[model samples]
Each structure stands twice: as C-alpha cells, then as structure tokens.
Target: MKILLHNLTRFGDLLQSQPALAELAGQGHRVAVACLENFAGAAALLPEAEVILPLPGSRFLAGLDGDWRQALAAMDGYVRHVKEVFDPDAAVNLTPALAARLLARRLCGEAVRGFSLDAHGFRHESSLWAAFLEASSAARGLSPFNVVDLFRKAAGVGLGPGRFALRRPEAPALEAARLALADRAPEGAAGYVGFQLGASATARQWPPDAFARLGEGLWQGLGVLPVLLGGPGEKALAAAYRETCRAPSADLVGATDLPALAATLCHLKLLVTNDTGTLHLAAGLGLPSLSIFLATAQPFDTGPYREGCLCLEPDMPCHPCPFGLPCPIGHACRRAIGPDTVLGAATTFLAGGGFPAGGYPGARAWLSGFDRAGFMDMTSLSGHGETARAVWLRLSRRVLRQFLDEEPLAPAGQERFALPAAVHDPLAEQLAQSADLLRLLAGHAGLAGRNPAMKDRFLATWERIRGLWTASPQLGAVGRLWQRDAQRAEPDLPSLIARIERYAALVAAFADRLTRR
Candidate 1:
C-alpha cells in the first residue's frame, strides 16, 4: 500500500515524527511526506521516504505577500500533484491545526487519520491520537506517553522500542564540526558539555546567569568546557552569556546548520538544553542529554526519546501548565527548578549513575522517561507501574491536604468523604481512615487522567482487578496461592494498580454507608 504523511509543524516536531515514518516504511508500504518548505531542507534527511513534497504550508498561504487567488491557485496546483503524481491509499496528518485539517481533505487518499473537514464544513477527528492531541494542550499533565508515540498512534501504526532513523550527514560534516570544536576549545581543556541556551517559548528559557554558574562549576570540578548551541534566534542571548561568563567557553549558537550540528553533537560528552528541537536532534545522534522542562512542558509527553538522558521538572503545583497565557506567578516552574537543582542532576548523569533508586522524593530527583525506543519506555518514574497513584499521593499532599483533613461526619449524615476519626467507636475510626484514603486516591486520579492511554488502561485494568479480587474469596482452596503469586517479585503491575484504585472506590462507597447510619 502507498501512504502519504503530512506534518506541517516546525522542525523539532518534524524530527519527532521520524520514528512513525520508520514504522510506516517498516510495514512494507511505499511512503511519501508532504511538509512545509521551511522544513524541506530537514525533510531531505528522511531515509525511509521515497518522496518529499515541500508544499507551501497553510500558514504561509494565509500570510501570503500577494494576491489570495494566486496563492489559492498555487495550493490547488500542489493538490493536483498529489492526485496525479503520488496518489496514496491512505493519508495521515500528525498536525492538529484547523487549516491542516482542511488540507488533509484535499490530499489523494481513501482514508485519513487526523483532522478532516466534512461535507457540511464541520471539522472532525475519529482516531484516538486525534482525541489525545485535542485534549493535550489543556490536559497537558495527563499524558503518560510521549509526543512521538502519540504521533505514531495517530497514524494507526504500531509502537515499540522502534529505531528513529534520521539521514546521516557525510563524514566531512563531522570532520568540519570537530575542527570547529577543537579551534574553539581553550588550550588544555577537556571535552565539552553542550549548553543549549534557548527554547521555543520565553517561559521555557533558563536564565543566562544560571547557565554561566553551572558552566563555571562544571569547568572547575570536571574540567569540561561549555559549548553553547542554538539557532540564530539565540545569538543575542548567547553573546550576553559569553560576555558575562566567568569561565571561558565556546559559543556556536548560530554557527552550524543541521548536518554540521549533528557532527558537533558527536564530540560532546553531554548536552544540557531546554526542551527544544536540539534535544531531539541529539537523541537521533545518540548523544547523552539533560533536558530542563520549565513552564508548561513535562517530560512525560516530550522528554528526549532515549535512554541515558536525564530530565529535571519542578514539582510546582501550577507547573506542567498549558502555557496558554502569560504566567501569573512569574514562571514559578523555572524559579523552582533552579540552577542548583539542574547542577545536581547534571553531576549525577556525568558521574555515570542512573536516577536515584526510586527517583527523588519530590522536586529534587532526576526526572525520567521509560526510554521506549521511539517516544517512551514507561509512563512515570513510579518504577515500572508499581503504583503511579502512590507517587501521585506523595506529590499532591499540599494540594489535597485541605480535603484530606475534613472532619468526619456524625453516625448519621449525608457526608461520604467527611468521616472524622472517633475517639471511642472503632467503626467511626475505620470510616474516617477510609475517607482520608479516598481523598488521596482522588488526587492521584487527577494526574493519571491526563494521558488518555493511561486512563484507558487504568479503567480497563480496574475492572479486571475488581473481578479477580471479588473472585478471590470464592476460591475456597486456592485463594492463598493466588495471593502468594501476586506477592512475588514479578507481580502483576496492572492488577496491583487496579486494586489500589478499587481500594479508593470501595472506601468512598463504605464512607457513604457510614454517613447514612
């Protein structure tokens, strides 16, 4: 079968979709991609695509410098090319914009996966991936999967620890990049750590001073040089940082193109960056990375899609925000995950150690991904699904404390979650404890519900566990064996997680009965 893919987003997002491209190619289907001209140069690097159509994006046409009719005609010509030159059996759009949704309808494909306009002019998305993206911006904290996996899923492709194949540059690019690095290095300096200073959003960029301090310390303690990396947009900030930096460092912010940048990455011991395209670029090159996710970005959805990389996200209440508007708290996410916090994570990674055994208790641990080949390895650092809700309980204490401490209700009342502990009555005490547990479970649900995949799994697993637990008492002779098997080292995580959820639900039901007593 022939497949056409459309990704009219920016460069970084285009790169993240490469694994899905690989997945498409791996399925023995002929593949072609239609992308914006701005990313055409980068798209030229996809090895799996037999065709790369650098069509004008809807954004460009909407912002045309001349006649709208002519622009429309030009787009029509591109659409004609799709129908005539590279007719596809199906088309998948990874972008979620309304304009892109309309564009998908014009492509030559029998089936379309993302947004599409109906005959009456209403936009619709029928796939789970589409629903995830629609909910993503607002329910930002809910996803347990990364953007890469989400994109693959949207395309109706299988996901696993799939290899993300990017076009490799010629060896000359690597040679040139090494020379540039060597020339920039101070005499007797050790290898460098890349400092990607800027991000797509103003909220995501870390302060220049913080980087300077981190660079100086790395130089003093580890003999590592700081090599700043970013596009031309970061040139001014790079200049300011170089001027103020106490340690002499190399600034390559606007010096290299994509190929050369990949070559440059090959020389670095590690790259510390804001959640940016460069981080994904490094991932493709197999370079170790440490990404700092500030503001609304969370590692769960967009962390570097590789192993041996560390991410640091603040445990701020308003964090993992949607970032739809100006921050009301001066970007407390950034302020909370400060230079000191970043330095510690950097130190741990460079020291050749993994994240702490169970991850940092709260705000100060190495934030991690499951390292699944394409987009994720696990949903949370909650240790292979032992109990993500337990992590939620620990993380949300401050937010849920108010409700958790509500006074228990009297022997007969309407309160289901307000059972106060009684000094004399054991039944009242049990009811009160159940209420507190219910509050904690509700808080965990708040985070677990963000990712649609996890939410689906949680519910499905909840029902399955309920069935098993309910049947356990009926297994007259083998009940103890079933319980013992569940307690082994290789316990069933989904079943365990489901029981935890069931426990919370049961507590609420129990509390409801006590209040009416």
Candidate 2:
C-alpha cells in the first residue's frame, strides 16, 4: 500500500517525525512524504521513503499587503501537482495548520488521517490525532506517553519503543566538516564538544553567557575542546560567547549545512545543545548529547531518544510551556541552570568525573531514552493550539466558579453577560504548580503513570518547597503531609485529597484576591 505523509512543520518537527516514516517503509509499504522545500535538506536524510514530493517553501503562499489572488493561484498549482502525480492509498497531514488541512482535503487519497477538511470543509482531526497532539501541550506534566509514541498512534500504527533511522552523512560533507574542525582547532580534532547556541525560539535558547562559562569550564577542567554550531540566527550569540570565553574554542556556527552538520556531529565526543532540531539529529545519529530545556522546553516530551543522554531543565512552573511564553521576570529557567551545573554534567560525560548531583536549586537532570520497562524510545513533544496557562486558566476559573456557587455571566433578560463581575485570574502559575504536585503524588502512589522520572521530579520538587513554605503554616503542613504520603508504599487517597485541598485552598485564596466580587 502506498502511504503519503505530509509534514509541513518546522525543521525539528520534521526530524522528530522520521521514526514513523521509517516504520511505514520498513513494513514494505510504499511511503511518500510531502516535504517543504525549506526542510528538503533534512527530509533527504530519511532512511526509507520510496517517494519524496517537494512542496514550495512557506514564502510562496505568504499573504501580500493587498491582493493575495496570485499567491492563492500559485498554491492551487502545488496542490494540483500533488493530486496529479503521486496521490496515495493513505495520507496523513502531520501539521495542524489550516493551509495543511485545506490541502489534505484536496489531495487524492482514500484513507486520510490527521488534520483535514471534512465534507463541509470544516477542520477535523481524528480522536487519536487530537489526543496525541494534545500530549505535547501544557498538560504534559500529566501526560503518560511521549510524543514519538503519539505520532505512531496518530498514524494508526502499533506503538512501542521507537527508533530513528537516518542515512549516513555524505562523505564529502563529512570530510569537509572534519577539515574545518581541524583548521579551527588542530590539537583536538574529533575530540571536541559542539555547542548549539541557538534554538527556534529565543525563550528556549540558553543564555549565551552560560554557554561561554560552560565552554571555558569544559576546556579548563576536562581538557576537552569546545566547538560551537548553529544557523544564521545564532551568529550574534556565537560571537558573544566567543568574546566572553577565555579558553581556546572554535565558533563553527553557521559554517556547516545540514549534511556537514550531521557529518560533524559524528566526529564530536558530545554535544551540549538547546532544545532544537540539531539535538534530534544528534540523538538519531546515536551521539551522546546533553540537551538544555529552559523556558517553554519540556524535557519529558522531546528529550534525547537514546539512553545515557542527559537533559537539564529548571524545576519551575513555567519552564515547559508549549509556545515558549515570554517570562515577565526574564528567562529565569535558563538563568537558573548556571554554567556550574552544565559544567558538572559535561565533566561527568567526558573525563570520567563524578560531578555533584542535584546541587543546583531550581534545576533537575534527566537521562533520556529509557521507559519504565527499560527500552529505548524516540520521544517527541507536540502541542494543541492551547498553552498550559490556557488549560490552567479554564480549570481555575471553572473550579473557582463552582466555589462561588454561581456563574458570573448568565443570561439576564436579553443580554448573556449582563452581570457585572470581576474576571477571575486563574493564577495559572500557582495552579500549574498545584497540578504538578498532584500529578507527582498520583505517580508516587502508583495511582497514575508511575515512573522513575516522575518520582525524581516529585522528590526534587517536594524538597524545594518543603523549606520555602515555612511561613505559611497551612500550606507547609499540607505540603509536608503530601510528601509524607508520597513516600509510602501505598498512599491513602482520602487523606491525600484532604491535604491537597488544604494546599488548593491556599492557592485559591490568592486567586480570590484577584477575583472581582
């Protein structure tokens, strides 16, 4: 059977979706993927796709300041091209964009999944697709499955441990990358550690100063060479790091293309990078990597796909928003994971060193690739059109309304919202934290998806808060009780809820202050 998959998302998303693409091909089915021209380079590295259909870059269909007829007409041509030449027995639109939905409807395929337009041309997603995509959003702290599994489930394929299969890097590019590295740092050619200084979002990118400190520490302490890598967007950050870094380092950012980049990653001893496409590539290549997950980057969702790979993320309420929401107080999550923590992680990976564990406050370390059963899985993350804050806001508002014993806005005569009421502030960050604790407690009690990581997160968080809430007796007592219950082999649900409500009431009191009477 010929299966067509259209992945019109960004580069990292394209890289993460490869496991399923490889799976369909490995099953002896003819597989074709509609690749965006921009990501055609990454798409070329896929292991087994019988056909690759190139779609024009996003620039082609971008709306003009005035008339958009010309662009619309051109888009119709691309749609016609796909329908005429290589339509498949099955099609799946991996992206949730409206344009992709409309195009999926136009494509000639008998069984189409994922985002599509129905008979009425309204956007639609399969129940499985909806659930899978939702797994990556703000409620990820509550989600039991990884995104790579979600992708397989969305495609109607059997799920288990996933693998990322990639074609070998082009020999020429591989050699070219080696030569470039040699020219930059002749003493330690392939023994260097590459730093990816850029992520798709600035929110997710670790601060340049932290990388500079880490690079210096790696060179000064571990006798390891530091090599930097990124696209054009990272040039400024790369330059900043180069200026501040005291140790000898090579700034290879923007110098290598995707093929050469892949080639170079093979030579490196390890990569310490932001949560980006390159991180996924390194994982696919079986490279030992340390990925930093800061603001809006969730480690559990898109952490490395292999064991022995490490991840560093701040244990803050706002660290893992799907959209990379801006921090009001600045990038606290990125700043919290200082150079010392990264240095410790790097040294442990390199010079056979035992670094101090979990010394840094507000930061946590995670080893990727293993599930509860100890199998390698290619984990990925996805988001519905909602943020974590959005979910929390709704939940907070609904529960708060229930507490108030009346709906704030109800039909009064002809007006639906005639009543004057204060818009209830969800106090999302507070609510999200409450939710995280509850989730952890549930996992620890074996009531929810119990796992090692869940316990680690719960313990780490419990320890952090146990001290800070000393002033608030009610909150502190409830939290201590919750922690005490979590340590038990079997936790009592009724007792847990009583304590949970004690903590919830405290948070609700703050929300109550913000709520207009």
Candidate 3:
C-alpha cells in the first residue's frame, strides 16, 4: 500500500510524525511524508518513506512573521503533489491546525484520514467531517485516536504495542557525526552530553541558567562533555550557556541541519534538553535523553516515548496550558525539576546499569526487520481501480451524516469539524485492515489482540445505534451526524436522536474513567 503522511506544522511536529510513517513501513507499506522546508532534515530519519515533500511556505508559518495564506498555499501544493505522485491508498493529516486539515483534504481528494481536537463542541468536528464526507465517508471515517496511534491505525498495521523506534542514519553519516564531535572537543571525545538551549519560543523553553547549571554538573560530576545544539536563533543562548556554565563545553547551536544533528546525537551517550525537536530527534536517533517539560505543554504530547529517559515536571496548580502567558511566579517549574534529576538519569544510562538497547528495564524489545510473512498475511494489493473505487464510493456526505449531531451552521456554529473525509476515509480502511495485521503479527509472537471482545462489542453497538439513527429523519438529520456532514442536505433526524443515547453512554464512560483517577 502507498501511504502519504502530511504534516504542515513545525519541524518538531514533522519529527513526531516520523514514528507514524515508520509504523506504516514496518507493516510493509510504501510510505511518503511531507514536512515544512526547515523540517526536511528530520524526514531523512524515515528511510522507509518513498518520498519526502517539502512545503516551504508552511515552514514560514512557524516563524514570527507567519502568514496564513502562504501556509495554506504551501499545504495545498504539497497535497496536490502527493495526489498526483503517490495516489496514496491513504492520506494521514497530522497537523494540529484545523484549517490545514480542511485544505489538505480538498487537495488530497478522497482516501484521507486524520484526527481532530474536541474544541467548541462535537458539532465543530461534524463540520469538518462534512468536508471529509465529500471526499470519503466510510462507516466511521474519522478516528478519535492519539497522534501516534492515529498513524498506526492509518497504516493498517499493528506495531505490537511497543515503544516507537527510530532508525539510525547510514554508517558513514554516523561515523562522520562521531568525528565531528571529536573535533568540537578532543579531550571529552570519549562521550558527550547533548544539550538544546533554545526551543521554538520562550513558552516551551526552560531558563538558560537552568540548562547552564545542568551542563555544569554533567561536566564537573559526571566528567561528561556538554554539547549544546539548536537552530541559528539559539546560537546566542547556547554560547551564553557555554560561557556561564562550570563545565567545559562547546556550543553547536545554530550550527547544524537536522541530519547532521540527528547523526551527531546518535554518537552522544545522553541528551538533556527542553521540550523541543532536538529532544525528539535524540530519541529518534536512539540517544538516552532527558526532557524537561514546561508548565505550558503537557507530557502526554511532548514526553519522550522511548526509554532510558526521564520526563520531569514541576508541581504547580497552574500547569499544562499556560495559554501563551509566562509563569507569573518566576518559572518555579523550571527551578523545581533541578539539574540533579537530569544528571542522575544520564549517569545511570551511560553506566549501562539501567538503560539497555530496548531501553529501560522491563521495556519490550522494539519491532525490527520488516516481517514479510506477517505483512503478507495481513494485506495484499488490490486492483488499483477496485480499491480506489471502493474508497471513492465510501466518501459520501450522506453516509458521514450518520456520525454527527445537529447542523453546524446555525446558532453557535463555528462550522468546526472533526475527521474530515479528506482525512478519514482512506485512514479508516487502513485502520480496519490494521486490526487484521495486528492479529497476524501478534499471532507469530504468541501474542493476541488486547480487548478484542471490547472492540467487537463496541463496533456492534456502534453499528446498531448508527442504523437506528439513520432510519429516522429526526435522528439522521440533526441527531448524530448533522454537523459533520455539511453536504448532507437531508439526514434521518429521528435516527440521530435515537443514537444520542449511545453518545451519552460514551461520554459517561469516558468521564467515569477520568473520575476514577
């Protein structure tokens, strides 16, 4: 299967999506991905990907003088390019921006899948779905899964529930990286501690002094060399840390591209950095890294997914989403996690006592060597037209109308949407297929799907409720799938009302889970 992973966000976001593309390739599917111009270096980690497209204008949107029109045009160009070249079996929209998802869906046509945040209301999601329905509306087009799981589901492959694994660069690149480090600081060439002092903005960054202290400790106590890495914007910050810190270190910030940095991090024994792309890059390159999260971002999205790393957050009432405001109390969160915690993790990892190839103790070994037999059993190439036709037929707005509730255009409608068809139709097919692939792969390893019966029951319940909702005019039109199916002029309104009960139960179950903790 040919898969196109579209990310119109930041370089960090592009790096994060690498795990998803890897998941597809691990399952033996041909995968290509798009990133903003600046993030092209990160795409190099995805050797399995067939093509890496760049949306230059989208990269511009990440900066201070960002423009929405240029970002949209770049996103459109990337989508059209993928549509013409890959003609992907599935298109995964991984950008967080709702507008990007909307435009990308139009450009990709049908066979699209992606995620949406539950902002405003379910109706906002519905509006998005309406656009999606126009593209490809399967039984349940959009899946409400986490970012990582979204790709797994999109690829129609089961990675066996293991931690995400990133591939190392070519041997020559790796060797060159090591030599580059030795040139930077000859005496501490045995091993170095990697540091990233700058992030996209102040909100996501830790205090420079905090990084300085950590670097100082790594040098004085662990005898580890401190190597600061960041973009050109971070040069001064890295230089400042190198000057003020007690340790002997070199500032490589703003000095290297993604590939160079990734290759270099591969040779480093450990990485201590803020919540930024470098943190993720280190993990992807198999470096033992510790990530310090500011109160503005949550660990659920930014924490290191690999082992041999520690994620530290301060105890604060006003946390997670600072909403563009700096911590008023002099950034206590940064001060609390402390340099000792980072240094301790680094010492334990390099000593090889706690960290292993598979990561920390008890961590499962990563999936390696693409399993041909397992993939064969799970998926087979269908006639190009057969799958495309099936996909096209499924992308109906009327069909998508079953999953939404109320019209998104009236009253409080921001016309927000969820899984747009341009994003979900192709993805759901892949997800449905992933169930089979997961079962096949796990079967080889004496493993079985977890909660199989739960999924079965859920699907059964979902179908029944959907049938009921679709049967009545009231339910079909405004009860369930109204908001998401913008193209659906008429829906079974009564069926939608009937299906509301199921949604209520789902909300209740979700609340119960949250309440239990």
Q: Give the alpha-carbon lDDT of every model.
A: 0.65, 0.64, 0.53
Candidate closer to the true structure by TM-score (higher is better), 2 or 3: 2
Ranking by TM-score: 1, 2, 3
Of candidates 3 and 1, the better by TM-score: 1
What does candidate 1's lDDT look like per residue over 1-517, in tens digits? 8888889888888888788889888889898888888788777777888888887766456747777777777778888888687888878888778777777877743377866665565655545345545545444554445677677777877456656667877788879988998898888887889999999887888778879888988888777899999889899879878777889898898988877788888898889998998898888777888787888777766887776677766666566665467888888666666666667667766776554434433352344444423346433442423233223222222221212222232232442322223311454454455445445544444546565555655454434433443332111111222232233232454544454554454344433443211
Error of 1 at 509 (Å): 15
Q: For residues 85-198, could you state the per-residue lDDT of candidate 3 as single tens digits?
A: 777776666553565455445554445565333323121222333333222222221212223433343333333553455667778877887777778784744578788887
Better of 1 and 2 by TM-score: 1
Off by over 4 Å in 2: 63-67, 134-142, 186-190, 321-326, 353-362, 372-517
CA RMSD of all predictions: 13.5, 15.4, 16.1
Best by lDDT: 1
List residue ranges in candidate 1 displaced over 4 A.
58-66, 83-85, 353-517
* Stretches of model 3 off by over 4 angstroms after superposition: 26-28, 58-84, 96-99, 115-146, 150-163, 186-190, 355-490, 510-517
Instruction: Return model 2's CA RMSD, one decimal.
Output: 15.4
